[model samples]
Target: MSLTDVIEGTRQATAADPANAQVSFSVANTLVPGTATAVEVRVRDHRFAVDEPAPLGGTDTAANPVEYALAALGSCQVITYQFWAAKLGIPLEQVKVTVDGDLDLHGFFGFADTRPGFTDVRITVELAGPADAADYEKLKQQVDEHCPVLDLFRNPTPTSTTLAQLTG
Candidate 1:
């Protein structure tokens, strides 16, 4: 009868059935040519080539995992900037960030490969806003301190991993 009633009806009709809920499973799979072949990594229902160029020979993406880490930081910086811009009522025309890091190819801990972890990272951001340089600089400082992801990365957190077996 009312707008709220009509909207609620539409929402209920479109919502998934709670009685027969669906569960999502995350899994990773990889296949290579042979013992001589390169490595491959597959995850989240997508496959990627570990050796040659993807699609051509395969999805030979950039450095393993490191690329993802860089992207994560860059994305967080952009999102944080946007959040502050909206809160301060600064109309932003564009927001951009460049994240770079260095690592030794050799694995640490005297492993098979002596790849070194990221030694350093640099992030550069560009934002267009009505706020003056002084205000923008202050906001940038605040964002660096308040951004959760940035803080987490800046100060490493201890973590543990466990493998669980599912039983039916």
Candidate 2:
């Protein structure tokens, strides 16, 4: 089918129920439920306080640093794909993301010349549903192109840090 046909079909499916099609919520959490006695998220931006988990290396159970990276990439892919699915009206039965990264302890601990973080990362996505191969490929391309995390990874932004003391 032509690109227009594919897009039109997806639209038809998504428009069936706009209300239940999706819900929006800002996701921020410190840790999994039951793992900690209390969770607190401190936003320096002064918006509001949210109950979030303590630092990863803290006494409380925390997801490893690598897991956090995987989570970010995986979440970005899933959300990006879902958004397109809803907009295109594609019947997305399932979307699975598996991210893997490799690093060396020597580099991480600062004994080596390599970077302290992940040297390489791989994000694999599996979509379940019925659609032509070309259509599926197009969907995958769009998701990859639009995924925020992927864009960030592909074209990294510079970061700067400053130290300050809080006065009481």
Candidate 3:
């Protein structure tokens, strides 16, 4: 529906579960040998494919995984801005954002000691709103502090993996 509906729904859900407001999301993926690298991912009722760049081995069919991560981060930042702006009664006209990352492929090819993921990422938000620069800066600070994906990238979250095989 609308963003207002999401905001109101979030408010009601938080009120209902004040103590533990946690939700779990899951996605399944499958891979098969082909000319190009590809993975079929199913999330909820949606299905999509992820592929690497031509140099990386794919035919540049779809966005690579790291690109998807950057996209997710950018999207989460926008959502944070919208949610907080609504909650704080700020007149947010429009939110535009750009996210970029630097990569050191040495780590991927097992060359140097560089990290495997984005070495650095920058997100620039161009806000079109009635609020002045100070208000915009304050809201951006709030987004940096409260955005879940930002936290996920900035800090460490313990994760466990389990594997099971299906017999045919």
Which segments of candidate 1 are over 4 A away from where they belong?
1-59, 108-115, 164-168
Question: Whose lDDT is greatest here?
Answer: 3
Flag the better candidate by TM-score, 1 or 2.
2
TM-score of each: 0.59, 0.64, 0.89
Which candidate wins on TM-score?
A: 3
Superior by lDDT: candidate 1 or candidate 2: 2
* RMSD in order of candidates: 8.9, 8.9, 2.0
**Native-referenced Cα lDDT, model 1:** 0.67
Go through the candidates in order and give the clash count of each. Answer: 10, 7, 0
What is the C-alpha lDDT profile of model 3 across 42-72, one tens digit per residue?
9999999898999999878789899999999
List where candidate 2 sits over 4 angstroms from the true fold: 1-60
lDDT of 1 at 127: 79
How high is the CA lDDT of each candidate model? Answer: 0.67, 0.69, 0.87
Error of 3 at 157 (Å): 1.2
